[model samples]
Target chain A: MIQAQSLTKRYGSKVAVDAIDFTIQPGTVTGLLGPNGAGKTTTMRMIVGLDRPDSGTVLVNGQRYQDLRAPLREVGVLLDAKAIHTGRSARNHLLAMAATHNIPTSRVDDVIELTGLTSVARKRVGGFSLGMGQRLGIAAALLGDPGILILDEPVNGLDPEGVLWVRKLMRHLAGEGRTVLLSSHLMSEMALTADHIIMLGRGRVIADAPVSEIIGQAGGATVRVRSPQATRLATLLAQAGVTVVNLEQDVLQISGITAAEIGDQAAAAGVALHELTSLTASLEDAYMSLTKNEVEYRTGGTGDDEFGDDDSDTTDAAADAAANDDPRETELQEAAR
Target chain B: MSTPTTLAAGTPETLADIGTEFVPASTPTGPHLNAIGIIRSEWIKLSTVRSTIWCFAVLLVVSMGLAAIMAFGLDLAGTDIATVPGTDQARFVAQASTFGVFFGQLIVAVLGVLVVTGEFTTGMIRSTLTAVPKRLPALWAKALVLFVTTFVAGLVSNIAAYAVTVAIANGQGLHASLFAPEVIFPVLGGALYLALVAVFALGIGTIVRSGAGSIAVALGVILLLPVVLQMIPATWATDVLPYLISSAGVSMFGLIQFAQVPLDWTVDLIIVLVWVIVSLGSAAVLLKRRDA
Candidate 1:
């Protein structure tokens, strides 16, 4: 188990990780979800004692990482794929790390095989592909068979098969009552693999809940309605919490209400509906909406020009909702991948 | 380790079938991090890298090659072999045997800097620091391993150089026994100085995390500082010349004397050690406080 209390870190004038508190429980895969600069890497570094926090403390297994008798046996951290020395072979790198904790050579070979790195283990890490580098890193982390595993972007450069292997490996480790914490910006991957998620926005915990709850909390499902009298139907569906967006002359995207309620209201109001559908919100949409305000480097496109003309405070919310379809957010996530 | 029966039954079966194949990790049964394991880890790290091998190879070759050249190129003209006294003859042979240490120090200095800075440049220090999060043990281990290995390498090269020098000097009718105190002391002292130079470089490497930058600084202190001080032509510069690391280090091995009043070899050794202590102490302080 890892517990952080008011942990904060700053680099010069900029705050890298603001005061944050979290407890990662054992026996589950907890995903750290955030944008690129949301302090995910910094937080992980502090947990492993690679970076010292400006204030407060982070405890791994009820003790500071520096104070642990055998840190490698208590916490296994894969900070990055390139953490291993490039001059050394993959096997030699693992062997040197194993020597630190007095871990056996058999365990080293076991991790090498476990990570599917037996073929390339004898080769220098400098020549390995990015996928192979990731495998070597995972192999190092698993060398001591630690109870807590912290992997930062473990599947960043892996192929689909490797990605599947990591997901399964995480689940398998967590099944044995180990604490598995992995960080990624890929909400879809986290949705499939994580039992719980701690979402960060500009170094602050924006959402902390189970995966299903996080998905359900993205304002629930949205309803799409196509009618001859789209404007009239939009007015009929309007309420205190309802949000209606006009997609075209005949289509309306309505949220904060159900399709059944919209269809019943439209039929009662003599507004003939051509089509009505309930669109469940995916984890991707939830991530975008949650991090829209927290993106460090916002991608520029048509949204800026649209938001420029409407400088009024009242139109800001409506303009932002329209800018959601700008596609730049998807591009940013793709760029991160 | 518990069985994964429920884990296999719960998740959907995929083509990889990775869930069933996964074996849970057991608790680590081995002894925790200790001094011996850390030192062994550092030895493995030092020996596995190509740069270390290349540096040590260059050191040995240059030492023997320079000794042979010095012995062969000596002009013993106009003086009969019987005219020179035994102590003077032994001193000449000892000087010839240890002449290569003047250059060997530079090679080992580079190796020392590379040993630590390589980890920083390649991001391997993060892995090392995470493994030994107490931080100081890793530094001490690296220093101890570098010291011992360089010492052994230096001793072997010095002994070989002595043999080469003696082989050629004997042909020129000048003889010096390897076991004599005048000859053997300098040879052993030269090797000790080389080992100390490497450790001194290790301390500098820790202070400057970059490979190129640390090497430049280490070489500058060992090779350039004495020359720059000599060029100053000042009383203070002359007075401070003997205390410089390179001057005192070379003198400690009876290879050269920079001071007008030659210091005892023991005093020179102490002066060289003071430099090492200062460098390593500062390195320890910065290493313990800084983020990895």
Candidate 2:
């Protein structure tokens, strides 16, 4: 278990991680979600004691990281894939790290095999690709078999197969009652892997809850309606707490009302309907809306309205389609197949 | 706990359903962080790198080669070579054996800087600091390993140089006992000075935390400071020259006298030691207080 209280860090005048408190428990995977430069990496660095907190304390397994008897045995951290020396081979790098804690060579070989890096363990790290380097970093983190594991961007450059392997590995580790905290900007991956998520925005905690709760709270269910009388149907469905948008000629996107209610109202109003489908928002859509104001680097006001306004139909429709093309939908389709 | 244990052990089919690839990670059982383990880790780090090997090889070759040339190129035509005093002959051979240390000091300085700066430049320092979070132990282990290894290498090179000098000078009627005080003391002292110079450079490397910048600062203090001081042509400059690191270091081995009044070798060694202490002390402070 790891506990932090009022943890704060600043680089000069700019605060990198504002005062935040969190507790990561064992037996589950906790994903730290954030945009670029949102202090996710800084918070992880502080947990491992690589960066000093200006105002608070972080305890790993009930002790400060520096004061632990054997820090590697208590917590394993993969801060970045480039933390290894380029001149050394993967095996030698692990061996040297193992020597510091008196860990044996057999354990090093075991981790090398566990991470599926035995084929390239003898090669210099300078020549490894980004994915290979990430595997090596994971191998190093698993060298000690610690009670807690913290990885920053573990699946950053991984292939689809590699991404699946990491998801299974994280679940397996947590199943064994180990505390696992991983940071990522990919909400779809987190939606599949993490049991809980803590979202950060501009050095502050924006939301912390279970994955299902966060998604449910961020987005209300919306329904897509198709009819020949699109204008009449939109006017009929418009009411208090309800939003209707004319998506092209025959479709209307309605929110704050269920599809059955829309269908019944259309039938009672003597309007013919071609299609009515309920659209449940994916985690990606929820993340976009939750962090829309917290983004540090906005691109040309493109992210101003995630649901798109009525003025720009083509661009907004394209953005909305892109947001809905999430991996959870693909997984659902595959399960159905 | 009892229910989960029963579920895990009761059904083989359930276990197989989770996939056979999910092997349980074995618990790590080992001793905690200790001085011996850290020192051993540092030794492995030093020996595995190519730069250390290259630097040590160059040091050995330069020492032996310079001794050979000095022994063969001595001018003995104007004097009766056989009639020279036995003590003076031993001093000549000892001087030749240790002359290469003058150049070897610069080589080890560069080696020392690279040992720490290589980690900094490659981002390996973060991994190292994370492993030993107290931070100072890593620096201490590195210094101890570098000092001991450099000392052994320096001793070997000086002895090899002495052997080459004896072999060549012996044919020319110059005979000196290897165990003689004049010959042995300077040989041992030269090795000591070389080892100290490497440690001094290691401290500078930690402070600067950059390869090129640390090398420039270390070499400037060791090589250029004395020259610049000598060119001042003042009495205070003359007095301060003896206290400079390179001047005192070379004087410690009796290789050269920087002061007009030549002080004792022990005093020169102390002067060199003070410089090393100051450099390492400040380095430790900065390393401990700064974020990795």
Candidate 3:
């Protein structure tokens, strides 16, 4: 468990990480989702002992990270892909990190193969592509087979196959009851990857709960009813204290009601219900809604919503759907191999 | 395998029958990430960087190269003049060996600049601090490794230059051996002075954390500031310059010190020590306070 108590970081007059308190549970993949400058990186840096918090403390396991004897083994952190020296081969880089913990050279080789960098392990990181550099970073992170893993934007440069491989890897690591805390602003990716989400908008966590629960709460359940008597049905739902929003000609979006409830209401009202569906908000929508007010660097406000990330959601969903096709994760590991 | 003891996260829940909720996060994991470990890691990292190797090689080349040419040139000029005052052909050749320490120190300063600056450039400083956690040990280890390596390397090169110069002078009919009474102090002092100055520069690099800033500051302290001080009417410059690491170190090479307050051998060593200690102390403090 990695716990940060009232962690705060300030650079001159600007506070980067404002006295935020959070904990990363074990045996779970907790996603730290936030905008570009929303203090996610600063919080991670403080937790891992890279940056000292001005007021507060971060504890890895029970003791502070600095107090840990075998920090690399206790908690592995992949701060960024470029953290390793570029001149050294991936193997040497891992070896050097391994040497810190007195871990054997064979373990370095094991992580190298684990991260699928065995083929390119001997290549200098300077020559490796961004994807390969990320792989090397993963390999280094796993060198100690640490109990907790902290990764900042771990899947940034991975290919589709590599991304799937990472998804499985995180799941597999979490399955083993290890703690994995990762940060990503990609809401769809977080939805697919994280079991729990901590949503940050500008250094403050707006929502912290199960990913599905957050999705349901922030973007309340909306019931879509298409009927010959849309206006009549809208009146009924509004009378029942549900806000009704009209979209197309005969469609009415009703909140605070379910599809089944709407069907019953329409049937009793003698409305010919051609179509009725409950559109629950996605994790992305929930995130955008909560962060809608606090996006520090808002591009524009005039659009339908600042985060009309439907395209990104579709792609990520498509990728997740494909990965989920084979219930047998064996295929993924095999394909990854 | 024993379960790794970590803090209970988020919503608290009872663990087992024991119900040991939050026991301040125990570390069944062994040794503390102590200062010594940080120092050891710093040593390995400093050694592995290619900048270290290249800079030392440059120090060797320039310092020894100066000795070789100076010895040959001085010996060749002494055909008519058998002896010149307190300086003879042999003495001049021995003295020739020590001139390069000044230039050699500058290159070492550049080497020191790269040591800390390279970490910033590559963003490895974050990783380093994460490993060590308490940032002071990292700085201390750097100063320890850099001072030792730069010092030893500087010393070896200086001696090698002296030996090679003696050989060249012998060939030119002016024999001066490394074992001579007057030979060891000047040559060894030259080497020690360069190494100490490099360490002084390294501390500056650690505090500044910039390649350009560190080298500029170090060079200015040694070379430029002294000139400015000398321009003043007060003879304080004469007293102050000798106590400066560079000046005191250089005086160790010359037979008759020109500076009014020429530091004795003990005073020169103390001055060098002061520069290293004070600069490194500032660096250590700065490192502890700053974010990685």
Q: Which residue pairs come into collision in candidate 3?
A: A62-B25, A69-B31
TM-score of chain B of each: 0.89, 0.89, 0.82
Compared with the true structure, what per-residue lDDT tens digits does model 3 show for residues A1-337? 7767688888889778777777777788999987777788888888877777889877776577877777777777888899877666788777656655666788888898888888898777788888898888888778767878888998988898988898889988877777889987667777888998886655666566888777765545777778877767766666444566666668776677788988887788788998888787677766665665555235566574545432324323433443344343333223222
RMSD of 3: 9.7
Docking quality (DockQ) for each candidate: 0.36, 0.34, 0.23
Every candidate's lDDT: 0.84, 0.83, 0.73
Candidates 2 and 3 compared by TM-score, better number: 2
Alpha-carbon DockQ of candidate 2: 0.34
C-alpha RMSD in Å of predicted model 2 compared with the true structure:
8.7
TM-scores for all predictions: 0.84, 0.84, 0.80
Off by over 4 Å in 3: A119-124, A220-280, A296-337, B1-40, B76-93, B253-258
Ordering by TM-score:
1, 2, 3
lDDT per residue for candidate 2 within A76-145, as digits (tens), equals 8898999988888899899989899998999999999998999999888999999999999998898788
lDDT of 2 at B151: 85
Point out the higher-scoring one by TM-score: 1 or 3: 1
Give the TM-score between model 2's chain B and the true chain B.
0.89
DockQ score, prediction 1? 0.36
lDDT of 1 by residue, B1-292 (tens): 1221222233464312332233233333566888899999999999999999999899889888999999999787878988999999899888888888899999999999999999999999999999999889999999989988998898888888889998998897888898888889988888899888999999999999999999999999999999999999899999999999899989987888999999998899998899898888888998888988
Q: Which is the winner by DockQ between candidate 2 and candidate 3?
A: 2
